[model samples]
Target chain A: MGKSIESILKKYDNCSRDSLISLLQEIQENEGFLSEEAIVKTGKKLKIPTSKIYGVATFYNQFRFEPTGKYHVMVCRGTACHVLGSLTVLQELEKVLKIKAGQTTRDGLFSIEVVACMGACGLAPVININGSFYANVTAESIKEIIESYRKKEE
Target chain B: MSIQIEVNGKKLEAFEGETILTALKRNGIRVPTLCHMNDFIPSGACRLCVVEIVGNPRLVSSCSFPVSDGMKILTNSPRVIESRKTIIELLLSNHPDDCLYCIRNNNCELQSLAKEYHVIERRIHGNKNSFKLDHSSTSIVRDPEKCILCGRCVRVCEETIGVSAIEYINRGSKTLIGTTMQKGLNTSSCVNCGQCIMVCPTGALTEKNQTHMVQDALQQKDKTLVVQYAPSISVSIAEEFGMAPGTDINGLLNAALRKMGFKYVFDTTFGADLTIMEEASELIQRITEGKTLPMFTSCCPAWVKYIEEFAPDFIDNLSTCKSPQQMTGAVIKSYFAEQSNLKPEDIISVSIMPCTAKKFEMQRETMGRNGVKDVDIAITTRELIELIHLHGIDMKTIQPEITDSPMGVRSSAGKIFGATGGVMEAALRTAYKKITGEELVDFKINAVRGFEGRKEAKIKINDDLEVGVAVISGLGNVRALLDEIRNGKNDVHFIEVMTCPGGCVAGGGQRIGVDRSFIEARTKSLYDIDDRETIKVSHKNPEIIELYDNYFGHPLSHKSHELLHTCYMERDVLL
Candidate 1:
């Protein structure tokens, strides 16, 4: 947010507004997600409106507004997962976290998001935490799986 | 180059690269279009303007398809008509069946298209999307269920006004136009310009109705309801009653307001006069002191907010003079209060503006005194028409009367404030006199007129001094102008920026379809008033001169500063 990001902003100073997406990607790569300050500074450097930048950013699922929590939870909502009753598993996680999908927990220890597909249909009704995929997840097993992530955060 | 094209068995002449829709329209051939805005590039999103080509297997969108030599197009063939009917039926599949209670019932584009297509019954029924109504923004109210996703609002907000406050989120069936991160519009860099409302085909976006609040105040016995209307409102409000465009109904409006139970109906045009005085003084002070060059006019709330949010570095360059509406409201709450021995809270000040941003402007923290807001409510000209009809008062039957006394009198300069270059024209009229003890040669400054995105003029005040002024109505134009100024390409000392294109005369709250002709008519009406009045300068207004001589003492005086001036602060665009 200080001198560290100013140099990154300067790199894109010569870039045109069409380069907004790549610039946002570079910033998001450096930072976990697009912070409020990063977006504003990128807008200034690129000479693009922040609203326009946000619009372009929101178009891609890769760009997240909030930083991922200590442990990121992804529930598969693809056809395979849905057939295997992943909706109940996702619901259980939402109920326990007291936050819906696309929201971070109040403590910032965990975040939940619904992914369209993880591309592993064989391992149906899956939940992934911190890049580790957990297969055959059930409504009841969701508690222990989330507990493991919370324990890791601790 | 002219190109020959056949439309429905008739040969038509069209420009070489012209769109099929444009060609058909020029020849008086009708094509039903919802997403197609007159000034904007073709979106081809509506799929309602599909035309059958001679060789093409599928129907092509006439709006996006170009005219080629020897191209045969059937505008209303049975197949094309069938496709359009299906498009209309699909659009109505998810649209709410509440047109009777909708704000844009009769004026709704989709409803009219439905009427034309004879979509009496819903042929294709689907899942109705349940979206939370966004009343978070002070000015605009967004109802997602009513939105047809035509992308007209998105295009106008992004491409025209340079305020891309709302965008298309998600994809395919799940898509809906929303602010970044799906947050409420209040959190976004929405200047509350209401330009989106102007472009929206449905009642999806509308000005937050304050007419009920105004109506409630009118009923209250103890509360003194004082109403003021912007100069633009008088010229455009006539459109609601089927009158000719650019009609001056100020006198009739004053009489109607009195009939509707307004104890005092003062013209905000007088406030525009006061604005010219303070704004001219501010401009003179800036040039003389060389502090903030290219001082932007702060009369437009949306433009003021644009500076505050996007261009905070140039916030100091904004004129400190309160807008005419706010100035009039401040005067009503202060001088009017003192003269009438009425408490500030006891009096309710409402203004009928040709702007939706005025609704948001009334609620600004800086626009208040002693915890009492200057303007209680700001309703658009459309709302005023509704209130007039609700009260069962006809303007034609009423006697033409002048605006109420002490705050009523305004000059021709103030009248032009509704038009695009009117502010700069009025400011120069007075700024010329203030700089060198001489009036401008002629009141009409031709250089700073018309619908060009940006108008610039260099006025040689005398041998030593010259005032370089520029006026732009659209924020998109202002962005380019600002960049030019930053690059040292433009040495303009003063700039007047209005958020909505064509200034307040074609403001977001003016009417539904804001095409070029209506704007010209409205701008001409303002100039006509400016030309008709004997007092062409703000400083020459006898009431304003008396106001200074008695109460304020002078422009930029301590008393004047307290009520007629304000400041700006930086704002966050996103969370």
Candidate 2:
């Protein structure tokens, strides 16, 4: 893991701090999460402070501090989604999962978070349950969607 | 003179010196084209407008090809379509196909043209351009992946607004639209006016929206959501509701606020009038005290931000009077809260502005008072339209009603605050009267009015006092005037500068669907409103004048100066 992290950082040796963040984001997307050993190796290879590497990882919403669940639920909170009652859909998810936004369920079946404008104004309340878009969602529909995810996890 | 042009064996009549594309368009001929904006010089990079000329072996771009007498043009031959299709296919090869998830998805001209041409799939997806999003400024966002490198935004920034904050960085396929030194937009010489966002054909440039935060505030029971509209918004919001341009929807707007669950629906124009009272008094004090001569109006946040970032030397010349939107925010947080017996934190002040820079202006440290930010949220007229649509409000059928009293009652001087030279004219109306101790029999001061890039006039006060006034819109125009002043050619006693081209009426955050004629018509309506109003002078505004005499000390008093007159800081070093 450390060797892989060092190689990844070496690939972007000439990149700026912003570029490093982008590179780390891409790496995290592929690996699911950044381990402590991977972060130390990245810092050492990139010639940046470990604290600085952690700071960049924590700054953006796209960067996750912890490992995500097998199933990730992203509910859009953009203007269009809000208008179409995306918050209600989010609320239903919280109630069912017994967790807040950005928190995975106790059973590790779901992880939920809100995103800004997903570019769907007319079709609001867009739910990305397991990387698949479920547009024009309602509270009832959200429940049905989550049930499918739960059954898959089981 | 009529020029004969042959189009694929068909004779067509065109003017002597029109571009082939324009001549073709005038004759009801459709040609596949892009990168040819109506407002700026044509950059024939798209190559979709390539036409076969009779005498020329190679096809020429119709947009850049000038029509000559008896020139033969073939716009839509099989060969031309194939070339155009291939050009479009190459454009789509690296372009993102997630239109439903793009901000300008439906409204994008590029997307519409793509669908029209049926170039749905890309043959090549190798080595796609990967661009990280830049959300540095409060007014504008840059998603480089969406940018087609049309250079329209860059041209508009340089040619129109005269703020060349954005330019092409790197070279070729790696070329990206960014600040000169890759600085954060706020740190760059960006005025935060958002004119670049207006001309962008895709979702590459957009206003940083706080609509979700506003929605959250609206849902909170403890929070009192109060909204105020700038002078320009009343004249233009009607266009968003599909009403005729310049339709006065003040009543409907007020009624809509009630329907939208707003605790208070107020007008920023009242604060505009208040600004006149304060600014006029400050001008008089500056003249008498012989302190800062030729004071610049600071109402336009874009101009204020520009002066703060680039021209810090002229900070002393900036009139301390807070912008009307900020004035409304300050008043709502302090005076209005005291009157209503509500905590400052309970009141969520939102301004519906014609400008985007106001979003950044509201976040400045000087805007807040008593540990609470003066304004909680700032949404543009466009965002307000979206909010109205979300609530299913039938704006067309709703009858117009009056804005709330005291904070809503505005004079003609306040109404014209939307247009160029309006603030200067308003201040002059009150300043001349206050200085001479007589009414301005001729209320209309045409000296500062008009659409000229910059205008200057000398008004002789009581035959002994000559005060020079200048009005400038567009940051580039302001830069020229300021340069002249800096060179010791300072003849003007007062200067009013608005960052937008035509002023707030043609602001960066107004409705996008309206045509130039409609915007002009709406501007005319704003002027008409001022003309029709009985109260023509800012000093004559009973509410503001009463407030000055009672709670607040008289205008120019130390207390009034402290509360109303705020100073600008130099942001040059920070930048």
Best by TM-score: 1
The digit string of per-residue lDDT tens for model 2 on B465-515 reads 789998887777777777888899757889999888779988988876456
Badly placed stretches (over 4 Å) of model 2 are A1-154, B6-18, B22-33, B123-126, B573-575
**How much is B28 displaced in model 1, in angstroms?**
1.2
Report the TM-score measured on chain A for model 2: 0.78
Compute the lDDT of residue B132 as modeled in candidate 2.
Answer: 79
Off by over 4 Å in 1: A1-38, A66-71, A77-100, A105-110, A114-119, A125-154
Please give the range of 10 consecutive residues that has the lowest summed lDDT in model 2 chain B.
B179-188
C-alpha lDDT of candidate 1 relative to the true structure: 0.87
* Candidate 2 backbone collisions, by pair: B251-B400, B251-B401, B252-B400
